[model samples]
Target chain A: MVVKVYGPDYGSTKGVLLCLIEKEVEFETVHVDGFKGEHKQPEYLKMQPFGLFPVVQDGDYVLYESRAILRYFAEKYKNQGTDLLGKTVEDRGLVEQWLDVEAHNFTPPIYSLVKIYFASVLEGVPADPKAIKENEEKIEKYLDIYEKRLSQTKYLAGDFFSLADLNHLPFTSYLMNEMEKGFMVRERKHVSAWWDDISSRPSWKKVLQDYKNPYDVLKEMNLVN
Target chain B: MVVKVYGPDYGSTKGVLLCLIEKEVEFETVHVDGFKGEHKQPEYLKMQPFGLFPVVQDGDYVLYESRAILRYFAEKYKNQGTDLLGKTVEDRGLVEQWLDVEAHNFTPPIYSLVKIYFASVLEGVPADPKAIKENEEKIEKYLDIYEKRLSQTKYLAGDFFSLADLNHLPFTSYLMNEMEKGFMVRERKHVSAWWDDISSRPSWKKVLQDYKNPYDVLKEMNLVN
Candidate 1:
């Protein structure tokens, strides 16, 4: 049976799609329209109580949380495609460490920036300049740490492109392109190179081509500026 | 060689200690006092650039981030003690899913509350009732989800106690006892029972007896409250 992933094509869902593609897993996407608040409906709530994006259904088993889904496919398909978890126990440790770093440190500040930046455009709420500046500084501090780590190793979790690197694709893509914060990546030599390396993977390229971000769709429709 | 865990016996460090005890891993503590700004010092930052609690050094390998360390020990000692990653791929997926849930959804609001609740007591900074109310409400929402989850399974991941449950020990302990927010857990039937089960573990008991939280230490010192 093919893996069924439910949610939109953008955000963390893109990360899930990218992992499935890399793992060479047979899967189909079921769109949950966030704009219509379909995820908050009772049926969707049964699968994901929090009504979040990108819940995966594989046979009798069901799972939510994109990072968890990424780990699942990576472990399940360990031999088939890109080696995500890494080779040694130590390597896996670093992967888990960096994954936490991404979740706790990197994601929060950048995500805050994303919400603040997009709220003005999407919701007509004026973005707070102070909050934006604070978030940007936090992002820069974290990127500095990333720069140091990337200098020592080719990727965040060592030389391999594990889930640690893959997890950054969705938001960092926004930071680099859509959010016009590319300089945040470009300013740091090692982080810049690392971003280029991970973002250019064929799997991510396929996800980019196949899954149009709803925000971009809105842009094309002239509904969002 | 015994693992060398640096940083104080508080917050995340307690979680690491609990995992080590559960796994029956020999480990020694090396304190980096956060109260004295020791964690931010150069020597400590070399091991953990973010200057967070609980940096573990086993032999030549150095690892930080408490949850990552919990995972490292759990995977390394999979056969020795509690099966934290879960028995199968699907179980492991649920374990990872809830772990992310704890890190992403649960930790943020509760941590914010902790800071707000303690700031006035420890630093003589007036607490913001509005922020406290918002965080408490957010935490209650997440706990409702946990109540639903625990009703179906013995633990957050499944029937067995996994990292998902263990990871909640530290902050939840703070919430239940130190912060005097036990009502939050006690009000939810399944969540209350789950908390009682996990918090009563001998390993956690040992951690509690062995390591004292810095804030509590300060209180003893007539430094805080």
Candidate 2:
């Protein structure tokens, strides 16, 4: 049976969808509205106890958390597609290391800032400069580390463009292009090159072309009313 | 070759050490002091560019991030001892989902509170109440989900013990015993029972017996001047 995914096609679930596309896996998606509190509904909670989106139901098996879903596809479909998890134990360890870094260190600040920035853009409220400055500083320090790492290795885990690199695409893309924080990645030469290289991939571009912002996501579902 | 782990035996490295012991794997420890800014020095940075401890070296491969280290050891020594990842693809997906929960959702608030609480205990200044309250609230919400899950399944991932449960031990132990947040876990019936079951495990007991706090780690290294 094809995997059934419940979440917006272009929001938090975008990464999972991108992974499925990258792996060329067959999956069906049901858009769950985030703006209208649909994700918090009891039914959604039954599928995902945390009431978070992008939960994948593979026949009887269900899994939530976007990155975990990515790992699932990468591992389950290892013989097919990109082989995102890496080959050797060393490569796998390094891959897991960067995936951890991406999850713990990289995404938090960027995601926090993006949430506020997106809401501000939608609701027409000025973002807290103090908060923005703090989060940006956090991101700057991380990007510096990324700059150093990318200078040494072509991708985060190593020469291979693995899930560690692909895991970053959606969030970082939104941060730079949507939130206008391009300088965060672009200013650092290695990071800039890394971003350009990864974002330009056919899979990510496909995600971009099919992607919708939160506002559209809400409106399309008639969730605003 | 046996893995060589460089980091404080306690502090953040405690998780990796516990995983190693749980796996019944032999490893040589070289404790690195964080207080003296040794982790920031050039030599340590060569192994871990992030300059964070517990970087584990298995022959030519070196990996850092405590959770990543846990994953590495679990995968590498699967045949040696307790299997930490999971048995099947479904189980693995669920495991990764919970691990992601530990990383992105569960740890952030508890870690933030721990840092503040630790600072308060070490220095003469008081911890920030508002900040603590905010973090505690975040944790409380997550524990409600944990309580629900524990009611359904014996452990976070499932009935079987995996790294999902072990990954939680270190910070949570500090939060409950050290920071007097037992109520956070103990107040919730299922979560409390779950905590009790996991914390009393022989592996965790060994971790507690062998672990040292950062202050002790510094002193042992003669890093405090």
Best by lDDT: 1
Best by TM-score: 1
Label model 2 with its docking quality class: medium
Itemize residue pairs with steric clashes in candidate 1: none
Q: Candidate 1, after superposition: displacement of residue A14 in Å?
A: 1.0
- Give the per-residue lDDT of model 2 (tens digit) for A100-152: 88877888888888777667756767889999898889889989999999999
Query: List-wise, what DockQ does each model earn?
Result: 0.90, 0.71
Categorize the docking of model 1: high
lDDT of 2 by residue, B1-225 (tens): 888989877756888878888999888888787767889999998888777778988888778988778877888788888998889877888888998899878988988987885576556468899999999998999999889899999998898999999989988987887668899898899999888898998988987877686645545556453
Per-prediction TM-score: 0.97, 0.91
Off by more than 4 A, model 2: A122-125, A215-225, B215-225
lDDT for each residue of candidate 1 in A1-225, tens digit (9 for 90 to 100): 999999988988998999999999999999898878999999999999999998999998999999999999999999998999999889999999998898888888878887876677678899998999999899999999999989999999988899999989998998888878999899999999998899889999999998888677678769777
